[model samples]
Target: MDANEQETDREIVPERLFQSDSNTCASVCGAEQTIRKDFLDMLRERHDIERHTRWYDIKKKFESDPRYRIVDSLYREEYFEDYLHIMKEEKRKERELREQRERERHRERKADRRDRDKDKEKDKDKEKSRKDRGRSRSRDKDRERKSSKEKEKPKEEKGKSEKIKKRETPEEGEHREESDKEERAGSVDSEVARQRENEAEQKQKEREKKLRAEQSIREREKEVQRTLAGHLRDRDKEREHHMREECIGHFTALLTDLVRTPDFTWKEVKRQLRKDHRWELIETLDREDRERKFNEHIDNLMKKKRERFREMLDEISTLQLTSTWKEIRKLIKEDPRYLKYNSDKGEREFRDYIKDKTMTAKTSLRELLQECKFITHKSSDLIKENPNHLKEIQDILKNDKRYLVLDHMEDERNTIVLGFLEELNKRGPPPPPTASESTRRNK
Candidate 1:
């Protein structure tokens, strides 16, 4: 490279150090004096004095002139190179860590395989030892049987000799009887006769006692049996009485239910009554009374069902899909707070109605109406453009509770819109749309 090119290569990048208020180049230059000539010689000779300091002076001088801006541009490319180097180091570190984890997994699998092989070898050795021990035990049993046969022959010969000696032995006896002997014999006979008489008497007494005791026990058993029979009869009668009362109570309740419904067949009602007497009595009620009760019951059910239907409708209305601003405006006019409907309130009311509960639609409708109050113009416009955008608007409205109450009224359900004309007719004519019309601008 030539001297000029070498000088350019060592050039420094300048920063925005000068305040806008001051333009005196002399004072600014004092902070970072620049080299006038032989910049390459200064760079080569100044190996120890911070190279950045010398470059800083060059940077300050070059920064003042717009023509030197291109030279300043090169510094950014170098700075980017440094950042790239740092990123490469980080990537290398991550790769090494992943490789280390893979090595550990490989080592674990190898060690487990080796352990399995060791266990297999140990089992083979144990099986061999068991077979050898079984063979040795069979040979010892054969030797023991041979020794026992030799000992049995000597034992049988000894037993025969002893029996012959016993047969050859003779007995000796004296035939004379002394007075003492006779007296002793008579005493023995007398003692034995007394013992026989005593035994007979004891047996006879025990038999008589046993017979008497048996007769008394039999009589007592008969008495107990009679008492038990009477108690059982009383218990049966009590159970029958309780059963009859339960039957009567059930029939009475069923009869009242049957009387309130004209369509209730006499045969069917009697079955519910669960008694022949109740069935027969129900068939005799006056036709006029039966009809009145039946009409009253039907009216009550219809009124309840109508209320439930209204609640379900309110819930269904709250389930809006994404709607455009124009659609929202129309919905608002029909029901001013319609866009503000609470999905929770609508869903809750729906569940209750489905479960046959009465009167929750009003609260849910009111919540929906209140939410319509907070609709921002931009969002409201967006909601109105998409006619099918009610679902999204409902979701936004349902999630926010800030619209639960309105500035003018607490109960939004009562804020009747054009859509509620049918319900409002029952009350009276609704006042002309005053503020309602203002909310409905042309798209």
Candidate 2:
């Protein structure tokens, strides 16, 4: 029984240990998750992490915060990297969606324009066909009128001959009959000549009218042709512009991370780009334009690099408003960002950083003083009334973190406060509302 109890105790002891271990692990994981959540929240609230932001920069920027320090370094870096990737993917999707929308809108507008042009062409053709049909009807009517007149004229001539025959006596001489026949023949010839003259006049009028109609139609066609030519020219210009922009975009895209650096020369970059199929896209661009764009790209790359270097300097824990480049350089000499510029340039940038830092500190301190309920527009008068009031105000400001940032510059801080007081005094207090103004506002 003792041996059996000993074995059972051993088993129970191991089981308890296993349970305790599992609980500890669960608690640790829960705490880690909570810390990670807090850190991410802080990042979301304060930091605008972009694609270009580096891990080193983020670490230096947030290392002082409690939330950032709670998470393990490896986990923090992993989370940050994952967040950056997610953000970049989201931005890329958004950009693609916008471009797709723009392209769809362009296609819709183009289709609408084509439909309108087709409708206009159909309307013009309909109007032209209607005018042609009307002209044909008018021509048919004129022909019928002329034919009826010709038929009636012959009938009248026949009737006149019959009447003359009725007037003739049987005993008339042959010479008289011959003379009458000659007169009849002359009259018939004159009448036929008059009919021919009228027909010639009518033909001349129709020809002139036809020529005028043809001239108007030709003028309209020529105008339409000119308008079409103009539209074609404008369309070609727009197409060329779009092509040029697309080519430039393709050329810019060809500049990968390897070639997009301040260190890369235009000649070297051009050689590398020529090997790529995208080079053909910029064939329409001149050598000068290509070189110019290359130079601009380099300039932008250098500018971004310089800005990142400045941000690194801003985040350096060892850096101070009073720190010199010589001291600061020693601390950052091992950093890769430090090697980007020579000593002289780095010194100049450090000086600028210090100057900007001092200004920011001063501004923050001033704001703190302004926020104090003790300080007012009439602070100057109060100080004059009781010199202890100024000391009290200074004591109140010294407790704030912002005031400590510029505590070394006592005179500057005092000057800022005095200047603010002066400004407030000059502005003066707002006037009280009159009876009329109050009544109007109530209404």
Residue-level lDDT of model 1, residues 13-59, one tens digit each, is: 22233433255677656533332122323333433433123233234
Model 2 per-residue lDDT at 360: 87
| lDDT score for residue 247 of model 1 | 45
Which residue pairs collide in model 2, if any? none
Across residues 176-205, which tens digit of lDDT does each residue of candidate 2 receive?
Answer: 678879999999999999999999999999
Off by over 4 Å in 1: 1-189, 196-242, 253-443
Question: What TM-scores do the predictions have?
Answer: 0.19, 0.52
TM-score of 1: 0.19
Measured by TM-score, the strongest candidate is: 2
Error of 2 at 113 (Å): 26
Task: List per-candidate RMSD values in Å.
Answer: 38.1, 18.5
Please give the range of 10 consecutive residues that has the lowest summed lDDT in model 1: 168-177
Listed per model in order, the count of residue pairs whose N, CA or C atoms clash below 3 Å is 27, 0
